[model samples]
Structures are given as C-alpha cells and as structure tokens.
Target: MKSIDPTIVKKKTLIYIPKLNRRQRTIVSTVFAAMLLLAIILGGLLISNERITTNLEIRNLSPSLEHPFGTDWLGRDMFARTIKGLTLSLGVGITAAAFSVLIALALGMLAATMGKRIDALISWLIDLFLSVPHLVSLILIAFTLGGGVKGVVVGVALTHWPSLARVIRAEVMQLRSAEFVGISRQFGKASWWIATRHIFPHLIPQFFVGLVLLFPHAVLHEAAVTFLGFGLSPQQPAIGIILSESMKYLSTGMWWLAFFPGLALLIMVRSFDILGDNLHMLIDPHRGHE
Candidate 1:
C-alpha cells in the first residue's frame, strides 16, 4: 500500500479556504464609495462656517438653488436642518446599536459559557423581553423616563438588545460543541481565555453585520418615537419632529415641508439597509452564494 503524504493533504485543504476575490472587491468598493460620499457631505456641513438662516419668505419653499432641500413650516433652513438631523440620527443609531450589541455580547457569552442555572435565567429574561412589543415598550419607557433625546436613546437601547442576544447565544451554542472549544476545555484553558482566543474572532464578522443592520432600525425607531411625541423635543430639529410638524400644513398644499424630509429619511434608511446587506455578503461568502 502506498503511504499517504500528510503535508500534501494539509496544503490541499488550506488551498480551498475561501477568500475575497474580484467580485467581492467590487461590492466592497461600491459600498465604501456610498459611505464615503455621505461622510463627505455630512462633514462639509458640519465644518462649514456658513450659517443657514431661516427666512419666513422662504418658509415651505420648494426645492431650488436657494433652498436645496426646501424650507420647513417653521421657516428654518431645511437643508441645514436635514444635515444636522442626519448627524443626530446617525449619532443615536451608532451609539445605541453599539451599546445594545455590547450588552448582548456580554450577556450572551455569559449565558453560553457560564453555569447551567445562570444560562437558564438569562435565557428566560431574554425570552420575556422578546415577548413584549418592542415599539410599545420603548414608548412606555421613554414616557416614564421623561421624553427627550436621552429617553429615546435609553428606550431604544433597552429594546434592541434581545434580538442581538439571541443571535449571539445561538452562535455561542453552535461554537461550544466545536472541536476547538472542546479541545480548549480538555486542556483546562480558562473560559475567558478560550473565548477571547478562539471564539471572538469567529464572532466578529457576525457581530459587525448585526451592528450595521441595527443602525437603520435604531434610527427608524428613534424617529418614530419622536414623531409620536415621546422622543426628542421639536426644537431639537430631528427629522421626525420635522415630519410631525409638517402634518399640519398638508391640507394647505405646502407639500415640500413633508415631502423633502420624508424623502431624506427614506434615503438614509435605505442606504444603511443596503450597506448592511452588502456587508453581510462580504463577510459571509455562503451568504453571497445565496
């Protein structure tokens, strides 16, 4: 019988490991381009010395050179307000998503890697939270906490963690029985050391995709709560507040007041969603195949 060469087998196996190629590169490039363009526009607005003064004469004006995004009912510069609102929305979305994911990661890891009773308790809590209607729970929390930006942030962060926790729990559970985890256990490696050294690297891609997906939802939820009068104050210039105020002028045919803001919100949400999808595909080639 011929002796099999182990080195040759190892080399062949390693050669088959998937990696990003030209098509993946193109997709990543496109996504980055969109994000970069958005960043540039937002940065310019943030740093520009030019003030956007509100003019009553231009109030509710349609999109034109003088007022690119048109003017709001309050005579505020809609273009400037939209930029500022986008910044605020992005800030809240990123911060809330990050906080929620961190909470989820910590809780989920504990549940997956800790004692059985502890896991059971955390799992039960997660299930209980999931059973509640997220939006309604957020609204109640915001109202109880005294409605404003801070209230909205807390409410959204609290409501957002369950889904991420479930995802992380599922990932951890799948990983716990894998060969590497079992080997680490047999070697008496500390749980935290094994998790950090072996598990976290695997979890990072999924976590990032989750983070991106969370962004759009967080922004939308914040806007919705604000629109319903349980979130940011109207004077703060949030997109939701703008939309809420625009409702009164709808019957009067000042459609631009609502139209532009609504369009801006839709565009932003869609961008984030697309970015998330692209990221998911990039990070998981199996997903790309689908």
Candidate 2:
C-alpha cells in the first residue's frame, strides 16, 4: 500500500470544514449554552403553574414512560415539580446575581476613585466578607432575615459580591491611570464624567461575565438554604424541598425521587457555569487566542 501522510489527511480535513477559530468556537458555544439555559428556564416556567394538582392513584411510582420523573408520595408529578423548582431557582439566581453585581460595581467604583481612607475601608470590607465561609455566612444571614425565598435571595446576593468587587476594583484602579483618563483630566473633565463615560464602558464586559459567574453560586446556595429549611416553604415545589421530601423514601429504593430532581439541578448549574466560562472566553481579549 502507498504510504499515507497524516499531515495530508489533516490538511484535507481542514479544507472541507475549516477548523473553527477560537472566537468562532467561543461564539458558538456561548450561544448554544445560552439557548439551552433559556429553553430550560422558559420550559420550566411554562409548566410550573400547571402542576399543583395531585392524583393519589399514581402516588409513589418509579420512573416510567407515562411518568418520566416518577410520581411523588403525594401523587404529584415529579417532572412538573422539578421543572417548577428549577424555574424558581433560575429566577432567584438571576435576580440575586444582578443585585450582587450591582453592589460590587458600586463598591468597586467607590474603592477605586475615592480617597485612600475609603479604599482601605472598602478593601477591608471585601476581605472581611471573603474571610467568612460562604455557606455559613449565607445560612446565618438567611436565618437572621427570617428564612424564606427573600432571605435566601438576600443572603446569596450579599455573600457573592466580594470576589467580583475585588476584580472590579482592580480593573477600575488600572483604568484610572490610562492615557485617555489622564487626557480627560487635563481637559478638565470631572471625575464623575470620566467614570460614567470611560470607566463604566470598559467595565461592562467584566460586569457581564462576573454577573454570569455569580449565577450558579446563587442558585446552588439558594437550593442549599432551602434544603436546610431556611429558604422556600415546604409548600413550594422547590428542588430543595423535593430532595428533602425524598429522603424518607430512599430507604425503600425510591431513589428516582431525589435522583431526577438532583440531576436536573446539577444540569442547570453546570449549564450556567459553562455559559459563564464561554462568555469570559468570548469577552477577554487575551483569552481570545485560546
């Protein structure tokens, strides 16, 4: 047989479909991830309100075609419950992450632009928040705030901002010394004007990526607090409550109750994580080559 060159084959393959450049790949992945997330979220929301009814005749059934996620002890459709809970979690995650990012942006801007005393205070606050264990702090906050959806949202929002804030502060501090900023200062532009016009625009990419990165953490923490009975009420069809209710039946081989819901939650979290990472790669110029 004639000698076959792997290089020739590789070149031919590249010619047919041309390997996707980093930017193209990043865009593709980001869009796919975003679409998947949206589908899950919207699908969940569409069906969430329709799942309140129960049927005792089908209670406690295992996974089957007729009842994909299985029937809960209350004869509730596990699929519907899981979807509903996921929708709720997604809503909470988005809200909490947005609030956290806003707080971070404000504190970050303040720390970067204000006097050394203010910078020191903000840095100290960031360090203080970072020093505490996240879950413990979250639990404490949720408990103190009278444990519920609102409490979980607030807890997640408050606890997740420090790292992003530090990043923002560093970025702003660097932007402060940029050539254009100096030119603006020489032109007698006020600090507020420079910030609003220059600094904020540059920070948009960072803010978007950071906000996305905060979402999975918010969702997981919300679910955790709920599971611990410090979040949404048991009456609510939340993933945490579903899992909590499933524990009693695990001894009897009713594993699907917890399994399906937990898997769904894991998938949702992972999707958000992938979406954030892809967005980061898409936005960061240095990483664009990769």
Candidate 3:
C-alpha cells in the first residue's frame, strides 16, 4: 500500500474543524459571557433583599462609592432599578419570543401537513399580518388591551409570529417531501408522530435561530412602546420609562440616570443580536462559508 502523507491528513483535519472568523468568535464569546454574568447578577438580586433594598434609595445622587448607577429623579436607587429592569426586560423578551415561536411552529406545521384550504387560510392571515407595521400594531394592541406588561408581551408575540411562521412553513414544506418523511409515512406513522419525531428535530435548529433573532426585536419593541407611553406603566423601572423620564432632567445635568440604563440596554440588545448571528453560523456552517 502507498504511504499516506501525514501533512495531507493534518490539512484535511483542519479543513473539517470549521474555523470561525474573528467576528463570529467575538459574538459567541460576548453572548455567552454576558448571559452568564446577567444570570448571576439577577440571581443575586432575587436572593438578597438587603442588597436590593440598599440600592433603592430614592434620590438623584450622582454616581458615587455607595450609588454606582446614580439615583433616579424619584430618588429610587438606579442600581436596583437597573437590575430589576434588566430582569423584566429579559423576561418579557424571552417569554414573548417563546410564545411567538410556539404559535409559528403550530400554525406552520398545520399548514404544511393539512389540506390546501387550511394552508390558504393560514397563508392569507400571515400576509395580512405582515402587511401591517409590526410596531404600530403592537402599540395599538397594547393600548387596546389596557397597556401593561402582559399586553406588551401579547402584542409583541402576536406581531412577531408571522415571519417565523413563514420560515417554519417553508422548512416543513421541504421536509414533507424528503425521503425520511416519506419513510415515516410508509411505516404507517401518524402525521403528528412523524412531525414530532422526525421533522421537528430538523426544524429545531432553525426554530432556535429564529428565537434568538426575535429576542433583540422583542426587547426593542418593548422599550419603544413603553417610551411612547403605551406599554409598561410609568411606575415601572423599565429602561424606556427611565429614558422617557430623563428627558425633563436633560437640562439639569443629571445625565447618568438615563445614560447608564441606556448603555445597559444597548449592550444587551447588541449582545443578543450578535449571539443570534453566531448561533446561525454555528448551526449552519455552510451559510457562513457562503
């Protein structure tokens, strides 16, 4: 037998490793690290009443050794408010995205598996939703529904599903005609069984990608709606509410109240967006190559 070249083998191994570009690596690291730190901070806040209370002094004290984020105009501890707001914003974004993804998955699966009439109806509904401006529709829905966190979540979820539905529908349509799906059908498996077992596995990566991508949008939408005075109540410590309140004090030189929260929000949104892009690349390396 001819001797195999060790150098060529090493080159082949390197080729198979799927090296991430600089941006991809940075995104992955930033997202993973931020998520971990955020989780730790949130947990600490939830568990430590003293720590939480200590941060909630209601005065616009500038950033000092005692008050890191400075006090809000209401003298509420900016640090506590920030931590609380971060938790709320993350909760809203994740919950809304999850609900939207579930809606999309169910509707998309149904459309792909059912008859032409069902598919047509679903398609029409999706088109109708896509035609409307998502943010405007979210605001309108939230306002109509009494304007609170629940309303904002529901509104964001409802408006967010159509695009995800289209993606899921396309994935299902492709899988429905595939060999494995045909094999499942030939084995006398129920449609739901085949969908749940075989099809869903393939769909999950895409679904996850969609979920991550939806996160930044959901967060931004929540902030925007709240800032416009139609989502979260003014009493809530949401970043948008903080920013909105800061407008009056802009001339008074109390800039840290808005600046730190806004910075935190920006970091979070950017982190999630980068994370989504990295996840897409990791899940579909071929797309990265292109």
Candidate 4:
C-alpha cells in the first residue's frame, strides 16, 4: 500500500467552495420548508380513517416501529389522529387567513383612498379591533355563531385582519403620494383605477407574505378556541379536542397522548413561521443592500 502524502492531502483540503449569499440561502430554505409542510398536509389527507380506529386490545401502546406515535387509551393511532387534526386545522387556517387577507386588502385600500371621513371611520374600526385581545374577541365571535367549523372559520377571519389591515393601510398611504399615482390621476384615471392597477400590483408581494405569516396564527387560535369549548365540536378530530381528551389520561401515565399531538402542532406552526420569514426576506428590496 502507498502512503498518503501530507502536502497533497492538505492541498485537496484547501479546494475552494462557494458560499451562498443571504438571498440565495433564503430561497433554498423557503423551498425546503414549503415542500416539508406540503408533504405533511398531503400525508395527513391521504391517511384513511381505518388507521385511526379504536381498539382497546392495543390501547395505550408506547411509541414503537409499529405505531410511530403510540396509541391513545382507546387504541386509536396517535400519528394518524395528529396528522388528520393538523390537516383539519390547516384547512381552517387557510380559509380564515384568506378571508382575513381579503378583508385587510379592501379596508386598507378604502381607508387610504375613500377620503377623510371614511378614513377616520376605518381607522377607528381598526383601532377598536386592535384594542381587544384576539382570544377574547375570537371567543365571543365563535360562541355567538354557535360553535362549529363555520363559527370557528368566521371568528378567526374576523379577528385576525386588523394588524394586516394596518400594514396595508400604511403601504397604500405611502403609495398614494407616489409621482406615478399623481400622474395617473391627472391623466383622467380614477382613484380606484390607479389603486387597482398601480398600488395593488405593488402590494402583491406584501399580501402574499402576510397571508403565509397569518396561517400559523389562525391555526393556533382555532385550536385554542376549540380547546376552550367555543370552536369545533367534540366529535371533530381537531387537535384541540384531542388535547382536551388527553388531559384526563395524563396522570395515568399515558404521556404519549398529549406529547405527540402537541409536538406535531408545534412543528407544523414552526415550519410555516420559517417559510414566511424566508419568503419575506427573499422579496425584500432592502435585504441585498444590507
């Protein structure tokens, strides 16, 4: 056998490797995070109801290869239940967040373009919504609507829009003063026309990032209300319901009941949080300057 030369080994070790800049890194990470969340959503959707069936014979099994997340006291697979619950939560989150974004878009534009009295009224509405804690508002809305998927969705939609609306309002206010907007107005274009064509187009990136960022909050709030008995029904396979059920068995040494479901929820929320942050970074104009 030939002995390896130290100098040749050192030269090979010194070979240059290019490092990704902040923008490139952000793009790569955003893609990965998106794919991971998509996989979880898809997997949860594809899993059948049979996998989550209760069987007292296998009840309360610990985590193992056969049952990755273990079994609940009723012998339902925790993994399946967690995935299903997450998918349901995702549905609610997406629906609520989309509606919330639409609300923000309309109110934001109205407040900026509809003149002083309208602006003041809209601003006051925004302030009023912002003044109340979201949970308190959400609970009231959900309860008044009679507590189910519809109630939860509408409640979350109504409650989550103020912050994003404020951001959009500020952006539109800034855009209203732009030279192109003034030129458009002078050239016989209506305010609405200038807004939809010029200002709204510029806000697409901001709206998309805001939508993505809102998903986690919507999902979390939905779960919270459900846990508090003001959201989804007990029959629904929601994460909140699962958690509420798990509390009874926790002292009985069935730690897996609460542990796995909560962990999965956190992981899903964190994934969206990362995806939104990276996408915002990727699109930001000042990012490269920094």
Q: Highest TM-score among the candidates is held by which one?
A: 4
Q: Rank the candidates by TM-score, best first.
A: 4, 2, 1, 3
Worst 10 residues of 4 by lDDT: 281-290
Model 3 per-residue lDDT tens digits across residues 181-222: 898889899988988898888888888888989998999999
Candidate 1: the clashing residue pairs are none
Comparing 1 and 4 on lDDT, the stronger one = 4
Is 2 or 4 the stronger prediction by TM-score?
4
- In model 4, where do residues sit more than 4 Å from their true spots? 1-16, 288-290
C-alpha-based local distance difference test score of model 4: 0.91
TM-score of each candidate structure, all chains considered together: 0.84, 0.92, 0.82, 0.95
Sorted by lDDT (best first), the order is 4, 2, 3, 1
Question: What clash pairs does model 3 have?
Answer: 58-75, 58-76, 59-75
The model with the greater TM-score, 2 or 3, is 2
Per-residue lDDT of 80-138 in model 2, one digit per residue for the tens?
88888888889888999999999999999999998899999999999999999889999
Among the numbered candidates, top lDDT falls to 4
Model 4 lDDT per residue over 55-163, tens place = 9999989999999989988899999999999999989999999999999989999999999999999999999999999999999999999999999989999999999
Q: Comparing 2 and 4 by lDDT, which wins?
A: 4
Worst 10 residues of 2 by lDDT: 45-54
Q: For residue 131, what is the lDDT in candidate 4?
A: 98
Instruction: Report RMSD for candidate 2.
Output: 3.7
lDDT of 1 by residue, 189-250 (tens): 99999888988888888778888888888999999999999999977768888889889988
